[model samples]
Target: MFEAVIWDFGGVLTSSPFEAFARFEAERGLPADIIRRTNTVNHLENAWAKFERAEVDIETFDRLFAQESLALGAEVRGKDILPLLAGDLRPEMVEALRRIRAKFKTGCITNNLPANAIGSAGGRTLYIAEVMALFDHVIESAKIGLRKPDSKIYRMMVDALSVDPAACIYLDDLGVNLKPAREMGMTTIKVVSARQALAELEAATGLSLR
Candidate 1:
């Protein structure tokens, strides 16, 4: 049903960041949605969007993210929490990506920070290296100044992969990110669990990822 597959790096390819965020909240006694709420401070113009767009440097993002979160409640030190965001890679997803790439063009569209910004500690560098080797086209928001859920980034990914929206299926953990891709006529999968995502891919492309 699709000629191309698009993957989201942090949550879909890797274990969901929300899991780590949950651990952080439990450990720190912070609210459940503090991190997400902080990210939505200015909506599209929030610190996260700006950082992903490369409009703000790491230092600036640290300040802005801290300020935004502080206004809500707890004082979240962006630097302290940055390392926790690099969730461990899902080996099954990596294998599935490789299987899909053999028959379909694959692209990775992610809203991520530059390594320099996040300090690249906690095995992040190694994780990225292994997974990046699997993708044919990687559209990283930090590198491109375009974040997901924005219609433009979705267009950029398919065009760069030499495919059209209708021929592509995008998998993302966030509904917000999936919205624009679906609106652009790409088939969409909301990747809530590794098992479910693989099943969706199998149904979409007739590939036995399991």
Candidate 2:
């Protein structure tokens, strides 16, 4: 039986940020595809991994992003990049997390930028805090100097929770992020939708959700 549940914060708990990015880019007179492409590149180096790991500060990140945008032949600015981080909480997912917490040791495993800049960057801390309160532990990548898809971060979580890898179920929106966790022997769930994810959880743990 799975004794613990580790959830990714952005896509799993909330609506995907890509939606916000599309809207934001549309308003900025830039093609949504350009913004999306820029964001894709940003994710590879600047956003989640580096920020979560504290490898780069907000200023450095902004500079790097601007440079990347210029390199891509776009005029994207830091202000424009903010909307890419917006998130909305899904009530069903929040309730499901609560239910999971009541029955199993629960944790938040998120790749996030620094806490101070989250609000300005369109990151939702208040919403995150509400859902995170339900968890036994919260691991933010920035504070730990490790990011997702890295075996080290997964190991860190397993050690911190004191749970065997095989006894934990790790849910992430990104399949790549879940790869290392699954390799570490943790039960992995790729969260495509709140309903489907919850159903998977129910099957994995035999916890009926009414």
Candidate 3:
């Protein structure tokens, strides 16, 4: 029923950054969800959102995030954790991308940092290059001055793909990002696991990844 498949990169295609954050937290004796809390401190207006929108450079994000962490009683620096966020990729998601590319238009809607140039999202250039080759169109927030869960970026994806929102199936690990797609009439899949997501995709699109 869908003409296109839309995906989120970090938590969906690659292993979740939250996993790394939890590990880092465990190793450091810090509070759980501290990193996410720091990023979500101001919600959409947080430094992470600003960084994704390309409003602030990496150095600025590091300083801003460090300050946010300090406000929460953690002295962690954003720079120290940035390099470790390149999560190991899921081969299944890559396979699903290729499998669906043959029949349906595929796009990647990711909230990524500017290229490894500014030290934000450090060590991500090669991985981004690898994934970019797989998509028909890549909507990266850093390049376009927009980010997901904003609803407008989702519209931007629709315009770029030239597809009706109703004819697209959107997938993201975060419920917040998926909510707008559902409101826009696209079928939304909360990607809790690759097996669960691919099963839903097979059932919805009849493109079997198994």
Candidate 4:
């Protein structure tokens, strides 16, 4: 029933940045999940959201995020979180994408910062570029000024892919991002772990993902 498979780049294709966030928080002696809390507090218009949409520059985001976190009882600099966003790639997930791409149209939608945002850009950029090349089409929030959980972005992908929502299968680590696709008639899979997500995709696509 599905003609296309859509993926979210960050948490789905790679190890989650949230794991890095927790480690940062623990090392800093701040409250657990504080970074997540700050990001979620004013989700749509917050510093993190603005950065992803390219509405704010790195310095501006750093100041704004620090202020936002201070208000929530911790003063974490935004620049500190930038390095944490570059998670190690999951080999199995990358292999799965290669297999799936041979049979179905594949697309990636990611909410990301500018290329220069990362502290060490050389290796990271090359690795990400390699993975990104596997997709037939890729949409980035920083490049497009639209982030996920916005139904418009989801519509944009289906429109770009030239596929109806009902004929697409979407995978995202965030339930908030998946909800709109699911509502629009796409089969949605919420990725918790690589193993679990692959199993779910296997059932949905009737392919041996693992």
Candidate 5:
């Protein structure tokens, strides 16, 4: 049985942040494709990786992001970029997490930018408090200076949880990010939907759901 569970925050916890970005783009009259293109530089995951590693701080990252947008012929600002990071907690996922926490040590590993840069909206502080408090540990890329798809952060989570990688089940919304965890011998789940993920977790761990 897995002794611990590690979860990625974005797509797995709630709706993908990309949906928020799409809404933001439409509201601002910016090209919808610009956000996707910016994310793809050095591969679609590198921008977050660099931010999480502290190789680029928030101010510099914002300036560079704005420059890239302009270079790509889109008019966008740093403030306009904030919604891309907003997280919406899913009720079913929250319930599932509560159940998982009861049965296994649980933690979250996410690539997040500085909170100050993103600012607050929709009662975000409360939202963060509710979701983050659910975990035994939370390793944020911005705070920890490490981001995933990178193996180092995964190792860090394993170490922080005081569990063997083989004893942990790691869940991420992206196959690319989950690949490294799977390689390290952690049971991995690619979350497609809350219900599907819950069913998979039940199957893997023999933990009954409510």
Candidate 6:
């Protein structure tokens, strides 16, 4: 029933950076979820959103994010958080992507920082280059000046893949991002864990993805 399988890169294919955020908060004695709260406060217009869209440079984001986090309570530099965003990749998810790609078109939509923004190639570039080669198409927020939960970006992927929305399966870790695709007539999966996501993908695609 699906011609394309679209994925969100951060949480779905890699270990959630939220876990890293939690550890950072614990280490600093800040309240839990402070980082997440800072990002979701203004949602679309927040410092995090602007950074993802490449609307601001690293220096600007560092200042803006510090101010935003301070307003919420603790002050956290954006530069510090940039390192946390590079989550370790999940091998099972990558394997499933390989299996699925052999049978269906595969695409990736990632809300990411500009290349080298992390200040260390080891964090993202090395593994990222290898995994990115698996995708038939990739849309990055920094490259396209568009981010998730935007209907237009989803439409761009469908058009790029030349597939009907109704015949595509989309997976994301965020409900806000999944909502747009779900509304676009695609089967949407909110990835909570690799095992759970693969089970659902197997059911949806009739493939033995483990």
Superposed Cα deviation of residue 62, candidate 6 (Å): 0.7
- Residue-level lDDT tens digits of model 4 in 145-184: 9999889998998888899999999999999899999999
lDDT of 6 by residue, 51-120 (tens): 9999999999999999999999989998998989878889999999999999999999999898789765
On the 0 to 100 scale, the lDDT of residue 84 in model 1 is: 78
Return the lDDT, model 1, position 169: 93
Provide the overall lDDT of each model, using Cα atoms, as 2-decimal numbers.
Answer: 0.86, 0.78, 0.86, 0.92, 0.80, 0.93
9-67: candidate 1 lDDT, tens digit per residue: 88898887777877898899998889978877777997778888899888888888889
Model 5 pairs whose backbones collide:
none
Q: How many backbone clashes does candidate 6 have?
A: 0
Q: Considering only N, C-alpha and C atoms within 3 Å, which residue pairs clash in candidate 4?
A: none
Backbone N/Cα/C clashes per model:
0, 2, 0, 0, 0, 0
Q: How high is each candidate's TM-score?
A: 0.94, 0.86, 0.92, 0.97, 0.87, 0.97
Query: Per-residue lDDT for 48-159 in model 5, tens only?
Result: 4566666777776667777767777785665566767766778888888889999899999988777576777768678778888999999888887767777998998889
Q: Candidate 2: give its CA RMSD in angstroms.
A: 2.7
* Clash pairs, model 2 backbone: 52-141, 52-142
Instruction: Please identify model 4 stretches exceeding 4 Å from their true place.
Output: none
Give the range of the ten consecutive residues with the poorest summed lDDT in model 2.
117-126
Residue-level lDDT tens digits of model 2 in 35-83 = 5576567465654356568887777767766777767777676545665
Regions of model 3 farther than 4 Å from truth: 117-128
lDDT of candidate 5 at residue 141, scale 0 to 100? 82
